[model samples]
Target: MTDPDRERPAEADDEQPVDAEAFYEALDARGRPVVTAAEVAAALDRPAGVVDDALSGLESDGDVGRLDVRAAKTAWYAPGRADADERITVFEKRRDVIVDQPAQYTRALLTQFAHLENTNREGGYVYTVREEDVWNAPYATFPELVSTVRSALGGRYEAIEEWIEGQWERAHKFRLATHEDGYVVLEAKSADLLGNVAEPRLDDGVLRARMGDETAWVAEDRTAELKRTLYEAGYPVQDDRELETGDDLPFDLDLDLRPYQADWIARFADSGSGVLVGPPGSGKTVAALGVMADVEGETLVLVPSRELAGQWHEEILERTTLSPEQVGEYHGGAKEIRPVTIATYRIAGMDRHRSLFDSRKWGLIVFDEVHHIPSPVHRRSASLQTKHRLGLTATPVRETEDQEEIYTLVGPPIGTDWEALFEAGYVAEPEVEIRCLPWASPAHREEYAASDGHGRRQAAATNPAKIREISAILHENRGSKAIVFVEYIDQGDAIAEALSVPFISGETPHARRSRLFDRFRRGAVDTIVVSRVGDEGIDLPDAEVAIAASGLGGSRRQGAQRAGRTMRPVGKARMYVLATRGTEEEDFARNRTKHLAARGVRVRETEPVAVVDPEDASATPDGGGVGFEAER
Candidate 1:
């Protein structure tokens, strides 16, 4: 509100006091205190430039603050107050917390039992406590969690605190432990619940014998099913087994961990298990090595594919003092059971391979891409009884909405705020733009409308016009390391053919895949087109750009994983998601980008840059119009 003619803030400026009160009110009415500056400007019915000036004044006066605004056009802002004011603002009805001007320690304390939603530019953070957060809170006793909640809130929130206590107690009702005779045992905190809730809920095949009213002998083979069933029944089984600490294999990490990595290791050590939910390039692999060093015992690392297994094997050798003889790879190609072994989930879950892994008293078991822990084959790997368990993932999201199973099977989510990591220069936050394209031509639109179900979906996903847009993007970002992701191999092949790049798919032989990926990493090729295999298996940290030409069936985790491919320690990274306008791809694109948007990533819908019709004989396409250009 300061006059442009004034050298400084004007006197009698009480009226020009940034009008922060109105902005806050507008933001509150929008049901989220955090918003882009553009959003608040629209809500206030004021000129965006005027709103920007007022908000900037408010920020100067410490009344308003920005969240971690990224390189894109998105500028996040929220209300702030004096440091002496209550840092934690609880919304009882919504069960969310808005912490203003919170210190690093306060944020760390809150993460023990609250899910950090977003971080404000004022160094404040937003967090929400869910049932899973309470259940997985790294506390041996309820009092510890309560103390943390109260300390972070700066006082008791009676209604929410009581609700949290109830959730914590529910998690304690059932526990899975090792019986003295070397079998898995299920115990209930009370007799009635065991007899009434657990016993009847589990079949005879699951519970072999009733040791007592509150205890039962569980079939080792059915342990995974038992844990999953009780969890679905609202009584999650706690794994408190006296499992093996494996043979001693001591080593030290050659890498110095970042502060956040150290904090993660500290928390994981206290719990003896946890999932490291960090963005890609946040040193999760190195942190895992630190964990292995802390455990000082043989470890088993489970990955979804052989590429990741090999990556893990190489990382373990390079980061730790472990030698090649000390480490081994167990998969279809090779089967070795050394002290430190990396195995695919399928190999680890097999009956024969399961025995081999079971026989080794692994002090630690790390599940890379732990999001896969909930699948049928991967869930079998969760049955292992070990002293320490760790899961790692950039996106702990699943379309099935069963991501909580990952927490139950492995451990709680332990992560630094992604925004914090970005701010600290540990990981670069990628700019994401959703490019919606029109149909390739009248013929293409007609074919899409004429078809049904899968045919229609295929038409939208493989729109020929998208290839033109991709060409324009690559042309603009030339000399950048890029990966074009596709869901279908046929589409990938076509794009590869058009782009003159190698296409890597599941059908690509291991040696060929390895050679292409190596070439990409070595900068021999600036770009490559890949299929779904690149979603999780590809770990190229130097990728500067990711163009999701065709996303899979609207998987939120897949979208996040693709964006994570470019999260690096330096330089700007960008993600372009292409979808056919006026088709199911619109909804699919939204669903795909939802996770990254929720995590404070800037996800904007833009019209693709001018795409020409290949069938046209002229310079422009038929019925040509200027294309939508994403904000640079």
Candidate 2:
């Protein structure tokens, strides 16, 4: 039976989880060329013995070439491997694929069919393709998926491809479509499968009644749970329920979308849902607003913080024809729900606030920083039941469970090429470096050694030596706008005091914080020391240099956000990640920034010899150590 969804539509990349060629291409995506049976098993979510049998069959069929393990991992990893050589490594067993020196178009292609684990600085990347990735593949039909895989890999894996086919088939077994009677009904291909799979998995009250042998009435406000339950049960319910565009809030997009952004809007126009994952400065917010205008219904924009909410307020007012009265802020300071409301995730998820948002028939619900959607508290907002839901984020990095929940809650990951954006001069490529600073004193080293767990992390993160390094960077890049990031308020205060800059944190008065931020934006202030309050979604576009004096417990998202601060269109930007030398900080520094290193920024390491004395830190020669060039 040909399903309507499986039919080829004009949209090529629709974020469904199945594409024919993904399984075989997973084996070929970059890393070490020779994959063991265990790796294949992990990638396919099958057993090692089963993978070995499959590989053995492939070997017999002369479809797969086996190389000796003695070939050396580096030998298999061709430096800057291009499209023709296809320098991609697949550990199907681990369900991970690393693209080495990926072609610009390849990364864009991979996101359509795989979940990005991390990107490399050397134009390489790591991806994890699984049942969800294949099931949410952008293509409409199994044959189209196969065609994409063959086109991507220039070959195929019949065995794992079979696994992909089954998963894709599983995703289409059921759907929640609107009946002509204006009620949602769960329709399945077969009554037996629906009774056996759907009836058993859904909650007691969810399936209100049976309409026919293969369709059932879906309880009101139970659609989200029903879809989630069925999805976990290995059957992704296609939501074809009719969606209202809500009360018309007339507005026109004042900004022109890049080609990719336009394509994103087009694909989303068809499905009415998706997450726009673009790098910072790649204009995800712009694309999201574009979608808002396209939807043309009353919209609800949920942001991670009030700062972002306010930013969205300004952006909406500035970029669209929407009047200030048409838009309102709903967060800690405000609770006015207007035709187009922007609220914080914290408030939007609250019981009292839920009604104000849910009561409105929103034409669209845009989840900004969509990465926050998977959290326990934030996930509640996902139940708002907007037909056209859109999400926006620079870093979509999260736990597998959280990532999957985000995909399920909001929509599948949709992004443009980070490298392509950099290449096109749309976003500046940052010069990133991990600077290993010496301890301010032997006492600091002793304290770090004596501390344990979080204490140890804090000690290293707040090492006084980072101040000297930051000073040196500032001195060299004097007059350039800079922002120093710290993990603790105390450290932020100290850095701000030494630098003679304002320290903005959660405790900062809203008016004062706004004043400081405004001055910095206008170049009235050259720098500011801010805590986690400045870690995300702040519009500091003129920031030329960013220094991370402390790590956020080594979170890759935080690292990327810090580096992303200096990334803008048509400028040279630089980022410095400071870690105390001869400590665990070295490892933490590397671990956090590796995500940015590969995607578009090539990270260099520098270990300085000089140490700064805390008592006379300012007297230190040129801020503690002769600067070394990018490490070999």
Q: For each candidate, give its TM-score against the true structure.
A: 0.77, 0.78
In candidate 1, stretches whose alpha carbon ends up further than 4 angstroms from where it belongs are 1-130, 136-161, 177-187, 205-221, 611-632
Per-residue CA lDDT of model 1 for 116-174, tens digit only, reads: 66543344556788887787665667876786676566568899888998998898898
Instruction: List candidate 2 stretches off by more than 4 Å.
Output: 1-128, 136-155, 597-600, 608-632
In candidate 2 the C-alpha lDDT for residue 439 amounts to 69
True-structure RMSD, every candidate:
8.7, 13.0
lDDT of 2 by residue, 183-247 (tens): 88999999997899899888799999999899999996788888888888878877777865567
Deviation in angstroms for 83 in model 1? 15
The CA lDDT at 501 in model 2 is: 83
Q: Which residue pairs show collisions in model 1?
A: 66-121, 67-121, 246-361
